[model samples]
Target: MPTPSAPSAPVADGGLFCELYWGTSLAEAWSYGPELGQVHAAPDETAPLPLYGFTLPEEPFLLAERTPRGWRIHVPPSARVEKSLKGDAFHPVGPEELTGAPGRAAVELREGMTLRLVEGELRLLVQPSVVKERAGRFRVRDVAWLITVAILFLSAPVAFLTMGPDPARLAANNARALQVAHDKEEARRKAMGLDQPLKPLTEAERATQKQDGGARVNVPASFGVR
Candidate 1:
């Protein structure tokens, strides 16, 4: 007869190594890595295993608590953080989005470690990084939009020059101006009673109303009407 054995614990390979610092002095240093089948923290390797918390990497991808200094995780500049649960997709994790909590805020490191901030004592589990694709500066849609805007900006002056001013509109404006001038002149003539055709002066009328050729005026006529 064969004897059944107990299930063996799961193995943990890597986790975030957090070192809390105050000013230039190191306050605390802990490594959150997998030990056996559960997540645990160690001051070193021989330290006692304390069960802290659990994280569902399949779900929201994060399990964290608030700290006094807020959620401040230092990421290496050379490494980029990406996230994908189903393993086929991944996107670059932005700095703002990395401040995650109440949701998945865990980031995958390039060196095969998963990093997350936690409150209280440190506890960690191993989750491998999965990012097969990388993004560049400009996408196809972005480049197309930029090109369209540039074309519009550059062609504005050329379009304006080519179109010029409307000839029909200018002619209509000139005609309206001429009509306005004619109407003004006609109104003035009507007001002065000179709008009608003039009649030629008769000889008697002209003789009676004729002015002297010299500068001298008739004294009686100049002084009083007669």
Candidate 2:
């Protein structure tokens, strides 16, 4: 996932050239890899501007250009911290479904990972790094989703197969037998308790219990085993 080498050397009226590609989805094009933050920056005379509070990766993230200070990323106070944690299945910040942004925009996910957006769509700069890493190591991304779906898909048959055995079948039959046995035991318990006086129940507990036939069994005092 090599970036197309620095478009040019550092300039004063510092021009961070970028080629970004935003789409209805971040991954629709190229730039926005699956991470925290990617911010585009330009020189401002007055204020030390603030950025959104998306956190950065703990490890050294891929940066398009290296600074003389080495690959250093900054987190700003004004940066808006996300409502929830990252990798939450979808973006909490977005509902717009915007594809890309074009400018000297400094885009970042909740990580120190920074990309210098050269002139173009930010999508271009966002290489498929995470996808690449996952793909490179174990082809996890390629198969992960399928593996998950497969597990879910195979669940039905696997469950059937597990129960397809003699032991499981026997166990299941025994479970049914036991259930009947338990029901008979429960009935006997009710019969035993019926001879006793009623017990107190909390108001809420009694209210709920009343819905399901109170006290497990509500035989009248006069009723006998006969």
Candidate 3:
């Protein structure tokens, strides 16, 4: 006899980072908006944050995990990281005094990077900007293409639903079904010695049969008319 298979493992409810949030040694905080402590010179226009890849100021660093609300960075406790901070002069002063707050000033990790919290905001300092020249009207063309694709994506299902079966084909199928039913009725009638042609209903017969009034007339009442 063959050996039975083992039962599968139970599925987890949330992502790895989220499931481990409480137990993990690192203190975690969620970002409210799209910005993740981005350092921008332009104070008015808060541009979108930079890419994930960044330069670490020191060996001791935090990791940012993407979450539904926003990005979540995990920072190890001050007590756990105190010894490591001694090696770097640029590290936060008096490491033991450090406390993890949900929303405070952005924490500066290094020369080019900083992490801070303000109310519900979480912004990270990124490297200085690098200007890029536009590739001309090609961008406009790409936008147009994307719009066309989106329209097609939406309209495809509507078109499929709106399309109806051919009227001629439907009529032919109905006729075929009616013929089959008539043949079956004729066979039944022949067995009963009543295989005669079906006469058109007279006005009085139609009225008594309730065919004209949309009410089903009693069979005996219709037969009594003749």
Candidate 4:
């Protein structure tokens, strides 16, 4: 039998930079673990403020372990940092309660990249992807979702006022009501020019709606019936 693999070292132990807030955390606060390259939550090693909620600042730095004691972070001393890293940690190690896994596709996001998380990592193929460009003619899908959600939220009062006596009746009518809402939403989407695929207008479709005659349109009611 293979010499019993020396009990595998814990993924993180005494010291090393570790993210406390995980990804909810901004990229600016990852701190150095005094020893194991884990995040230092202790003051003597981490030194500063915020007894809890402390994390290593995310930036290039030299992380070294202190013997007998725990980890110590060498942060470029600053007034703001002095303010934040100025407290003591109750637990010698950083908070153990947090074993947070990454969100959606746990992929690390470089600054400004709007990442779509896939199976427990940042969706690959776009690692060093470009930051999102500003709004242009078309609203992106996320923007559309936000707009739809707002509309639904504003409509909540209407929903509450219209709820009937029976919960079952409410449930029974919900699908039809939702279907009607869907249809109305579709119509609104079309009016905003969002329902159609985006492409240059076809020459045939752009052909004169007037026969080059007067300001009046030459469109037959039958022409647009479909």
Q: Report lDDT (CA) for all predictions.
A: 0.46, 0.38, 0.39, 0.37
The digit string of per-residue lDDT tens for model 2 on 1-226 reads 9778644322211222223234323432222222223333332222122111222232232333333322222322123212223233222234242123321122222222223222222222221233311124557686888899988987998789777769867899999999999899888988888646787888999778768864566789898895
Which candidate has the highest TM-score of all?
1
Kindly list the per-residue Cα lDDT of model 3 for residues 98-145, writing each as its tens digit: 445632212223222223221112222221112122235658889999
Off by over 4 Å in 2: 1-156, 164-226
Note each model's CA RMSD in angstroms. 18.0, 25.6, 19.4, 31.9
Q: What is the clash tally of candidate 1? A: 1
TM-score of each: 0.32, 0.16, 0.30, 0.17
Clashes of each: 1, 51, 9, 37
In terms of TM-score, how similar is model 2 to the real structure? 0.16
Pairs in clash, predicted candidate 3: 36-123, 36-124, 37-123, 37-124, 38-124, 104-117, 106-115, 106-116, 107-115
Off by over 4 Å in 4: 1-61, 64-139, 162-226
* Model 1 Cα lDDT, one tens digit per residue, 136-204: 579899999999999999999999988999989999999999999999999999999999998999998
Winner by lDDT: 1
What's the TM for model 1? Answer: 0.32
Query: Which of the two, 1 or 4, has more TM-score?
Result: 1
Kindly give the stretch of ten consecutive residues in candidate 2 with the minimal lDDT sum.
45-54
Q: Deviation in angstroms for 115 in model 2?
A: 15
State the displacement of the C-alpha of residue 146, model 1, in Å, after optimal TM-score superposition: 1.3
What CA RMSD would candidate 1 show?
Answer: 18.0
1 against 4, candidate with superior lDDT? 1
